[model samples]
Target: MEEERLVTQVTPKSEDFSRWYLDLIRRTELADYAPMKGMMVIRPYGYAIWENIQRLLDERIKASGHVNAYFPLFIPEGFLRKEMEHLQGFAPEVAWVTQGGADELEERLAVRPTSEAIIGFMYSKWVKSWRDLPVLINQWANVVRWEKVTRPFLRTTEFLWQEGHTVHETYDEAQAETLRILDMYRQFVETELAIPVLYGRKTEQEKFAGALATYAIEALMSDGKALQMGTSHNLGQHFARVFNIRFEDHNQSLQYAWQTSWGVSTRLIGALVMAHGDDSGLVFPPAVAPFQVVIIPISIGNWKENTLPRAVELRSRLERVGIRVFLDDRSEYTPGWKFSEWEMRGVPLRLEIGPRDVKNNQAVAVRRDNKEKLIVSLDGVEAKIKGILDGIQASLFDKALAFQKENTCQVSSYQEFKSVIENKRGFVQAFWCGSEECEARIKEETMATIRVIPLEEEKNQKGKCIFCQKEAGTLAVFARSY
Candidate 1:
């Protein structure tokens, strides 16, 4: 109760976006700074959101023929060195352990910045024949990266994520799997999280360390900044050759296994916070909300005997119908206080059952998104609750889609690009000559980078390069990102 009272108000988002974001996280009890500089402790409420996300996404992954597995967190220096490009890409961010029980070890073990090196070693052993062709496996685990600047979920030293690694016999099979996972990620993020995303291929400068190509889903935050939601990479035969993952093919010839790795991390939790949250606090989509409905019994006359019982019964009924509900029966907080508390916590639906309402067999249902209230009859309440939850999920996605549409624009020249990026922050679409030099120049002059290059069809539509004025071959979305 004291903690609830302590959360007064967040800084208005329009006044200060960063402060508003940090303030909402603290007041809403999502996560907090850890004793370590580049780490955070995700609180129960925040972890619950992640748990729901994991449950939903894992179902999709498993259904797509990927099995969950665990790999070692530490990779030997020798193992990482085998794949020099991958090692070099992650060298700066990799954490290392050199001592064991106060004794210096012979070889330093690197904390996984990503699990490709170690997973490749194991795949080399497990995949000796073509029969083990498409080995689709996913790991739900935490990884360590020594980040200089850290936010709670967005850029932590250690974070929870699901990384999928697969091995296929042919390049086409691997490519298909990579694109399929990319589409899968888009669907899961857009449907379950209720956050609209623009997805496509990453530029050469932006692709994963050793991947042949990388694809990602990028979402526009409320502040008009881009947040990469997920990525799927096609590793090709690079890792297979590096790790000696040779297999006998159908033609009885030894061939390297084509590979892929893809993942989405708890950074998504930060995206959800930035995308849909308002100055009030978090505004979680119904599908991923910890408790979709919170039942607050009005603490009026004889509430304990009348309203409380009714509220408890309603909670039971809702739970039976597979709805997550929380009945706040604590006598210390007033109904108004509970409403404010739950609103800040971002429960999609709030039900108020007062003694008078209980007598009339009705409850006041409040929506977190629009603050709309509906007098709902207790009879057949499950159907109404389900409908409202569905509506909230769709409405949140629609609102985010509208925001993205309003913020995005096409620039004909670098001047317009710089102006749009500086004066107004959002996505700026422009034709690129597919040159890393031009990409670096834009990032240097204006702090915006190429976020995504639209897939083949759209990218192939040519125009003059926005930066160089040369005939360009690709359409790319550029933005300042988190």
Candidate 2:
């Protein structure tokens, strides 16, 4: 039997958000540091959450006219070099496989940081006519980017992600697909993961390398830091032109196909933990929680025989209604211990069935978020669980939205923006001059960078540039990011 643990063992988030994040990850068995620097071994519990996210996201991807496909992980060095800008951007982090078993290879193969190089080459061969224009395919795979600094799932040397690559006949069609997938990503995170994001276009300095435009969903963590949730890029003809990904138009003229690539990585799990987790541990939204409900059978006297059977029955009922549940029937641990463990694991709902509760034909229901206890009658318990889970999902997104709103504010002066970036940190909305020189100078002076140019209502508001006193180019969100 394991020794009993105190809930307060996990670091308080307010005390130190980073330490608290690592503590909760270990406590919940989400991920652990690997011997290799900047690498992580995702525990089964963490992978389960990712699996649920994949299931939900894959469904949406298929519904939106995209299919799954896989490509080579090792790209020839020359392939990455084909696109000069793309090669330059990832050159610093590219891991090269120089040897093949015994003899030294003539050409080093790059472990793909992203598959655009090799994938675009394949598309060049596969696409011959306009009929093959819209190749909407997504691949769920792992990519390696040698990171000097790493954080568990957030910025690992290697991480699992889904990369979507598509080709279109015209610029307009490709641009539309880019935004379409962007909206899909936003909907998935907000509705399924229950993490609200700020949707906007990336500045030239921040956009993906070699991309004509890049759009992202930026989310604010509870610690007043911003995290890039996901990104969609309109590649235009950059890769297609470099790789000869051309197709014969209806007029029989060879034209370069417009392309797009977008992805969201395991870093999302870190975002979820940071956004919704409390001092106790992780608090997952019901949709992605490995176990939405945990059943604890109170073990006192012969309640094992009494409470265990009812707990099993409740698990069966909840499972029948599509609720992911775990029944803690282990006799070694006390019910209180199980409750605390599951609470730390962030099960949205806890149903405790004891001798008294079974006798009273009710179960003690506890919510993980607020730790609210309710005496739920045994009748229609499945429906009640479903409703509560739905409510929990909504409440999580709303709470995160409220937190983002509370932390975010518009600043008019460079002095005020610098102060917020240094002393107080959240999202500071400020005007930008749309100059790369200005952006770099600001980032060098203040660790905060322009997260995204707001495309919503604030983009229309006119104001002077926060730094240079020039005309406003666009409204931008500035923050130090993970």
Candidate 3:
């Protein structure tokens, strides 16, 4: 906590985009690199945002019939090999433990890169018949994926997430469940985190390993690169068959259960930052902001007896109304420094009550999103603050939506696609022939991949493929992504 201020006046988000992000994270104390390579220590402020994210999403998941559960952090190696595709996909990144408590174990245990294999084993034991169908369970935990390269929340080796795994009696039920969770993810991220996302089916090249079909929500960051926000996959009895999760049907025939897996990780915190943060600092949506409002009392002589009490009162009122408010009455820091500090921390709104404000029965409010200032009367200030929080939340989503729309470009050919991808780095809309080879070629040449194939409606237009000169098969959005 005791370090030189890293955020002085360097231009953020313009020329040196990566530096801007690192500076904001370091200066504002969101996170810092840990002792282990490719891992990070999420500071308290960053953890608070994650807590809010968990709260909002957990409520939605529970309401949708999913129950919270826990599974082991390690999986038997044989379980991973049961699904060859999943094993091959995660084999390179898996960490192994061969010794336990000063004894060398006979079989090496794999750190859980994902729980599909272990959950599949449990499902086999728990689900026996249609009466036990639709076992919807979610686990909030940290996973280890030994990544070669990592960024704070984006690709850390160890990060936090909630993974939902469900089993259904029929294929149709599982498919429906997959889509239900996809829409749930879209709504949660857009409304709670203030990040608007593009929803669609993922291309085979990008779909989850071992999944019959994968759906994802893609968000455009401020720097023109795409960030994957969440993903849902229809497992289609693959894990059920492999793990022997069989059940009796209504007609007395034995059948394997249909399965689905979906998750969103701490990577979402990175998306939120890129989607809304500015040069000054983060611009958190009120819904997920640790402190929606920060109260600073601007005082002069004997002000502790005056403005401090008023500031405390206002803080109490705001707190009673369910607003996360912080009163900064520390005499060591000046009023201006407190404002900058809170601004860097991305409090949605700031309330400044000074000697004049106390005498006049008013306070000054500043918005972190736009840096707009308002002189507000103290009377009914709680209601006014509520309105301001809602406004800030909506404003952030609108601004991100507008930015995404503005950066998207529709192209008809590979030439135009390459040109646009090189000149402008946002989403490029083009028709894809639904071929893995063509998708690979395009990525090899332009370094941009299909972010998503917009949910069925965008595929209606008939045209030529952007990469291969074939009849248009599906409309897909392409971009250089993180």
Backbone-clash count (model 2): 0
Give the TM-score (vs. native) of candidate 1: 0.98
Say which candidate scores most in lDDT.
1
lDDT of each: 0.92, 0.91, 0.91
* Candidate 1, residue 308: how far the Cα is off, in Å: 0.6
Worst 10 residues of 1 by lDDT: 1-10
Backbone clash pairs for candidate 2 read none
TM-scores for candidates 1 onward, in order? 0.98, 0.97, 0.97
Model 2 C-alpha RMSD vs. true structure (Å) is: 2.2
What stretches of model 3 exceed 4 Å from their correct place? 1-11
lDDT of 2 by residue, 1-482 (tens): 13223667777777888898998898789988889888889999999999998999999999999999999999999999999989989999999999999988899999999999999999999999999869999999999999898889899999999999999999999999999989999999999989989888998888898899999999999988899999999999999999999999999999999999999999999998999998777899999999999998889899867778899899999899888989888989887789888988989999998888999999999999888899999999889889988999999999999998988999998899988888878899888878888899999999898888766834466778888989975888999998
Give per-residue CA lDDT, model 1, range 109-128, as digits (tens). Answer: 99998999999999999999
TM-score of 3: 0.97
Runs in model 2 with CA error above 4 Å?
A: 1-5, 457-459
